[model samples]
Target: MKIRAAVLHSIGAERPFQDTRPLVIEELELDPPGDNEVLVQIKAAGLCHSDLSVIDGNRPRPVPMALGHEAAGIVKAVGSGVRDLKEGDHVVAVFVPSCGHCSPCAEGRPALCEPAAKTNNAGTLVSGEHRLHRDDGTPVNHHLGVSAFADHAVVSRDSLVRIDPALPFHHAALFGCAVLTGVGAVINSANIKAGQTVAVIGLGGVGLNSVLGAMVAGASEVIAFDLDDSKLALATELGASHAFNSKDPDCVEKIKALTKGGVDCAIEMAGSEKALEFAYLITRRGGTTVTGGLAHPEKKVAIQQVSLVAEERTLKGSYVGSCVPVRDVARYVSLFQQGKLPVDKLLTHTLTLDQINEGFERLAAGEAVRQVIEFN
Candidate 1:
């Protein structure tokens, strides 16, 4: 089928996103899914931090790649042998799929699945090739195996999650990555229980959801920390019990006081070494400190060996919140439909594909909450 797609030709070493400078938006031929694959027609796409990572050289995935991994739409076709899904079903594409046979998935850790995990790094089709090409049949880079930036994309059946048709397209898109990771971090990774005190650092899309997850999981005190007052307000609206300025004079001290010593868990979403340390400092003995942000390669988080020993704290790194897309995406959709997920107010910006650069600019400037690209 012929569809519209933004083709990235070459990314500059200084800035991978700058590679879109020679961007081309035209008709492209989408290869039909082979057995074990499914084709989807993207209705809404969210411009997320991971997508930004690839463009800004933070997460390099070769040149000439299609971007936008956070997206939702409808299944247009299913390859032979795919039994669970059918054409015309609403679905969200999981950028990372769980191949049940992989070591991590088989071990109950889908987040670290090796075979599917290596695709983004390899920059090859699941079968080790590209599924998209120019009208003239020239090959282009595939951003992640399931590139939702295009109006239509082919993905492994394992990567497609069926969602309710009652869910709004844009809201459904956020669940594809950002919301899932943040919420899953709280519910799945931390398993935060009632009355436990928790801190969410960095109130972006991920951090805010972490705060919501804490509220839902019954945290006694959900402290939200961020440099922006606007985001702090949003966090409060989303159920944070307390708010702290990221630059407050006594932010750490105040968090410690509120929890009567330290919080039970600290979720670091800013991806900065300093921010992670601040969260680490305010965690009580035997508490857990989780790194939820995707920090750039140039950035590093340093941990004090003494703190680990003296506090008996557990520091864990979570990827996409240890989610099993087939299971988690549907649950999130139900949450959104029942208004358990405060999505309508959380997503704050909309633009077209032509304005994607501006959307990313707002993301870099910290000027937007969640910017989405609308295709009509």
Candidate 2:
């Protein structure tokens, strides 16, 4: 079937994405789902920074690839050998589709499943097949096993988690990435205890979710930092106890003085080495610094080697918030349903497929929080 999708032919396109028009919408032919695969009719898809990274050349991937990852949809059909799901079921797209028998999966860390990473980097499904083709018969690469920028997708059964049909597609879509990564970092990676002081750097969708997660964990002080004051204000309104401008020359000192040293846990959601450095510096002695950001592959952070030993400071990297989607997605959704995780506040704008270029422009400018493309 021919379906409309946003495809990126090259990386590092000029900014003001609407002008350069990096993502070109095209009607591509989608093949039926293979064995153990499910065909999803994408309902809502979020414009995540990961997608922006590809446009700005911060992250590189195969060209002619469908570009959205975080999304929610309905199972239009299921391929042979699929038993747990059926047509009409609602599901969220998980970027990493773990092969249940991988070493990481056995260790309860599907986020790091080796095969998932391999296929993701290769721009194919776990079955190592391309299910999309251009009208010219050229294969289009899948993004993180879910080319959800399209109206439809054929993904591995392992790449989806069923959600309550009552949940709104736009809100449920965020759980696939932003909510999972941000909340997972707090609950799973940090295991933050009540009364702990936490600081989150970079107030985008992921950072704000981290603020909510810290509040849910009972953190007494949730410090929010960002270069943008509007984002800081939004963070404060959500749950951050304090908001600081990361651009301030005295910002680090302010956080240190406020916490009487530093925060118990510091999270960096901005995909920058400098943000990671700030997160590390604002962590208290014996505290943990967690980075959920995805910096360029060649970028590296320079940390004081002695601090890890002397202060017992732990600098850890979090992928998909170290989440087990089948479990975490439902738990987070339950929290959302109970009004504990006010993720709805993060939804700043909704656009149609035609307006997606501008949505990305807003995202690139830090002018929007979580923007979703709602299909007809």
- Expressed as tens digits, the lDDT of each residue in 169-215 for candidate 1 is 88889888887899899888887889999899988888887887787
Candidate 2: minimum summed lDDT over ten consecutive residues — where? Answer: 55-64
Q: Candidate 2 overall Cα lDDT vs. reference?
A: 0.95
Report model 1's TM-score to 2 decimal places.
Answer: 0.94
Worst 10 residues of 1 by lDDT: 11-20
Off by over 4 Å in 2: none
Backbone clashes, each candidate: 2, 0
Q: What are the lDDT figures for the candidates, one per model?
A: 0.80, 0.95
RMSD of every candidate to native, in Å, equals 2.1, 0.7
TM-scores of the candidates in the order shown: 0.94, 0.99
Top of the candidates by TM-score:
2
Work out candidate 1's RMSD over C-alphas. 2.1
Q: Candidate 1 — which pairs collide?
A: 17-55, 125-129
